[model samples]
Target: MSEDGARDDGRQQRQELGSFLRRQRERLDRTAYGLPPAGRGRAVGLRREEVSYLSGVSVTWYTWLEQGRDINPSRQVLDAVATTLRLTDAEHDYVLSLVGLAPRPATRADAVDIAPAQVQRFLDALDEHPAYALAPDWGIAGWNKAYERLYPGVATTAGENRNLLWLVFTDPSVRSLLDDWDDTSRRFLAEFRAEAGPRLSDPRYRDLISRLRAASVDFDTRWNEHGVGGFVSRERVFRHPELGRLVFEHHQLRPSDHLDLQLVVYVADAETRRRFARTKD
Candidate 1:
């Protein structure tokens, strides 16, 4: 890249940093950090001075950093700022990248590819339980028969519409299938937001967001909320028509060779496990 081009990129990154910082601050509650709550006519979230104090930096320096001024902060200062914002893992990485320093590579849709046959075999091996794989974009990359029966149409959905967020927000069947659809949807959205990271400015990510907004009002509202979460194992209860109530915990596992793909497996409780065996019989 030319010197001019590099300078332009730096300027753009600074602008993004400023915007992201403001959004995070606006959404954070002062009281959540043991600080005074917003008084009448004051800002809804923590004030700039409060953040500076908490981050152990001078108010002028924090203000300059937020204002997109040409000032480079040390890694220590950046880490402090990130802690003050209570950023998610992805958000923390993105903030570092904006300053021409990337602690980790950003996961993108383009990086997703067909899962190896070995991955399919692994999912197939878990025949008695539900198991599947999700691509970087959260698309249904592969699944087993048990997973297909578990989620119904999810495994069969074609094209990019197979995305988890798309199905959760647009598919009526999905809304009816999950016992706690609202809670599940919110958490999934938060996970998706975390993965999106600095790629939010990318055309593909923006297009996906636009389509999601058109598909569901709730998704749009949640997206605007800027909530972020990690993908971790969690227990969920499902109402099965023939089997009655079933409990299962799901986890997201990444293969050492394929960091972009996530293997999601559902483990049933003792009673649910018995129900699955009986249903198979």
Candidate 2:
């Protein structure tokens, strides 16, 4: 199959996996929580309205989603149901597993193998722009020289804990790079919460959460809100020291086999592109 076809297949499989897991969880909850069984009801599992109420999704949309009909759900909705179901840490991990984000086994080693040389070369080739590779849990795996120049203080700290979310929420220097600090921080925290559900039991993840909670009040508040978000394509505004306010489109490219490695590319607008070009010269 062509690469596009392969990607489409992966997307479809993930959708099915997500829906199936959700249905199973709902059924389990109905029994465990003493809700009526899925008998003589208009729908199987939890009523569409109940799931919608718990997940903050419209009833019609939730029905379509659970029915495995034509509907796309944001990570936020899936997360809400995961929280409502009170899924165990393992069950939460299973939810993410459906989407190809397999949790790190407890016995697994802490050390993650470095990104391939080809990936490093790809980052380096973007000489005039910022580009970086992130591990599954959003740790900074590798970055280009230009990325370092543009996003100073990003990789200055040593070790595997150099996570972008951590830097944005806890580090003052990184937080200052954005114009809309509160809005951006909340969205970032939500995204991290969605991703971290599966890894909450891991000591490494727990420690990271503790450190961030202690470091930033904003992080603590948003984390407690139990929000969730996904990595969708979007435009971001950054306040650069040299270039001033600049806009860029953020794109995330996930690996088919490895899944852990994600290539994030930032493309500047025409004005920002001109500024970057002039700075490089």
Candidate 2's residue-wise lDDT over 120-158, tens digit each? 888889776678887756678888876776786866776
TM-scores for the candidates? 0.61, 0.59
Which residue segments of model 2 deviate by more than 4 Å? 1-110
Q: Could you tell me which residue pairs clash in candidate 1? A: none
Candidate 2, lDDT over the whole model: 0.71
Best by TM-score: 1
lDDT of 1 by residue, 103-187 (tens): 8556446645456899989998987678888887777788887776667786567767877789999988778778999899999
* Clash-forming residue pairs, model 2: none
Q: How many clashing pairs in candidate 2? A: 0
Q: What is each predicted model's overall lDDT from 0 to 1?
A: 0.82, 0.71
